[model samples]
Target chain A: MSPADRFARLPDLLAADSDLQRRGRWVTVDCRVDVGDQPFFLALENGALAAFERGTRLMRSSAFTVGATDEAWTQHWQPVPAPGWHDLFALTKRGVASMEGDFRPLLQNLQFFKDLLALPRRLPERI
Target chain B: MAPVLDPMIGRYLRLQIDGVDHRVYFEEAGRGIPLVCLHTAGADGRQYRHLLADPAVTSRFRVLAFDMPWHGKSTPPDGWEKSEYRLTTASYTAAIRAFCKAMELDKPVVMGCSIGGRIVLNLAIAHAAEFRALIALEAADFQQPWYDTAWLHRPDVHGGEACAALVSGLIAPQSPPVSRHETLWMYMQGGPGVFKGDLYFYRVDGDLREKVKSIDTKVCPLYLLTGEYDFSCTSEDTLRTAAQIPGVEVQIMKHVGHFPMSEHPAKFREYILPILEKIS
Candidate 1:
């Protein structure tokens, strides 16, 4: 019922999204999504989501890390989020979220990654 | 079979801009006051297809939309591969003026979106007397650096796909799927590096904050319309720009985004039709 929970379901959601698979067919990366104090790590292989888990040990590496407050993530997942919170770059520009690490993988697979993260919007509003 | 024909007519004109001959493609429909529509950056005039086909719009205003050189059906001038394409304020304004002169459009009402939107302000500042009025959509005098544009035309990335993906979020989710995809399709078809070249004017050379203050809206009425859903050119940005110029009209369109005319033409019409009527 939270953005973290939704993050956990991404593997399943992505496994079923054929269009996203095609879009990310060449993308392979290990990334981290930090929602406030919580961190969700994702492993994407080719077009499929290889693994998604919470918590990472010290010195663990990720291609990129997208960090924002849990509230930011929640608002971003709203069916129709407010203007500033509606997009990744928008959030970054507003200083609400931060993108760190190599940008090549993210930029090359921008639509897929953007859509992948936004998959949680389908959840009920009350959640 | 019932043969169907669209009112819109497409044509090419040989124009000499800055003493260089360039072939430009334009589409038009209707008659009366000339309403020149400028497409968004990285896109062609096809963005106004709906406006060109709409009888309501075509009946009163002669709507014309043209693709800038190196965009859509318009071909870049000779020896294009030898030089990097960078759309500067000076070159962009000259192209618009040259197109108008070549077409013999007399004091036409010019409407532009995004980069096209920003150029109208420049046009107003430099050549206000040459235009009847100017309508700017999703525009502002200055924009904070959002992202590096180099990724747009890099050999490592599919420039067209990257460009399309990056801007996809700028469209409001409420827009119809067909219209939204149609808008992105144009970005996907943009010439390699052309989108980034256009952004050079948008992000760098096109800051008009100090100069926008010089615009006398009385000489040529300026109407600015920004979509509520557009983060690229937020309504706040337009309001800030409007606040700089006295007597300039500003409207914040709801449920619309960057590509108003293309992404959601039907909804866009609700906002534009009234403005056109007001102009008439």
Candidate 2:
């Protein structure tokens, strides 16, 4: 899938997943290069950023290369001059906060709901 | 040219404690009394890198530095005991204590910047026998009654962005992208965890002011170092917080922000090394 398409569908996937429903319907895009720096992965998922990082339902930040590549996803990432380290850091922080705000309910009741889900439901006694 | 001193490189250890390998990067130089150095909330031990590099500074004492659990080389436990238990000052302090026991050193003089300082306070008080002296820089108490009225209500603070900048500053101005990423990830994990922990720490109604004052770690010649432009806490508030703890030696550095060690290492040593000497 193309980068834009994949990133766009991220929200839908999160919204559809029952497990991530608690993270609320929000998508965040994070990009990172692999260990070898050969391939980049862009994580587009519908849910709060914090949930991806700290909670379950693993999320990967989107990654791309600096030069030409045959991979379909790789073509989607065009050359964009990188910001200063400080500016990029600021952007990430803002984006994370924005994700958190978008998924406020999840951020708010995250602990309570997660704990509740972990507990076995107490079904009403059979009449 | 950043100060032309040798980069202090020593055994970066990983001690298995509480089911996780707690990585401690420590360099012991000029032994007299041991100084256990802890970095601020978002940064790792290397924040004190220059200060440790200075012969004038390292000449005074042996330094035990560790990237706190979930920070630097240390990663969070493979399996958490509980879901919401990953970010807690108490748990981090336990890891530090475990590291100390593993290394088999007396409490020595414990100095921490920002959250590091707060952890030291937590450790010293909870494990009173562990600490000989205490130094805390720009400790935050967002849950405090007064700060809630001021800090929370202030719209201009930009807490999140400010925090991000601080993170960038710590790692930036660098080489070897692999090392940089590793460092960044360590901080990313540590920052969110510590920030979350602080939110929990300050949720109480009564001020921690009294609890901070009550810590019995023998005053050990308390020292407070902060930047003039510290966004974490106002200069007035920093002084006030220092005053709450009886008989603390306070020094305010000019033309600096929240991360004094990063911005002004020489000034930091000027204020810090003397105390290390006295303790030694």
Query: Least lDDT summed over 10 consecutive residues: which range in candidate 1 chain B?
Result: B142-151
Clashing pairs in 1: none
Q: On residues A11-127, what C-alpha lDDT tens digit does candidate 2 reach at each position?
A: 334444565555434434443322111333434344433322221224443322121122322322222211211222222222311112222232233322222211111221121
Give each candidate's fraction of reference contacts reproduced. Answer: 0.58, 0.03
For model 2, what is the error of residue B35's alpha carbon versus the real structure, in angstroms, after optimal superposition?
0.9
TM-score of chain B of 1: 0.99
Clashing pairs in 2: A26-A47, A30-A61, A30-A62, A31-A62, A41-A62, A41-A63, A42-A62, A42-A63, A43-A61, A43-A62
> What TM-score quantifies how close candidate 2 is to the native fold?
0.54
DockQ, prediction 1:
0.74
- Each model's DockQ? 0.74, 0.03
Local distance difference test scores for all models = 0.91, 0.49
TM-score of chain A of each: 0.92, 0.22
What is the iRMSD in Å for candidate 2? 11.1
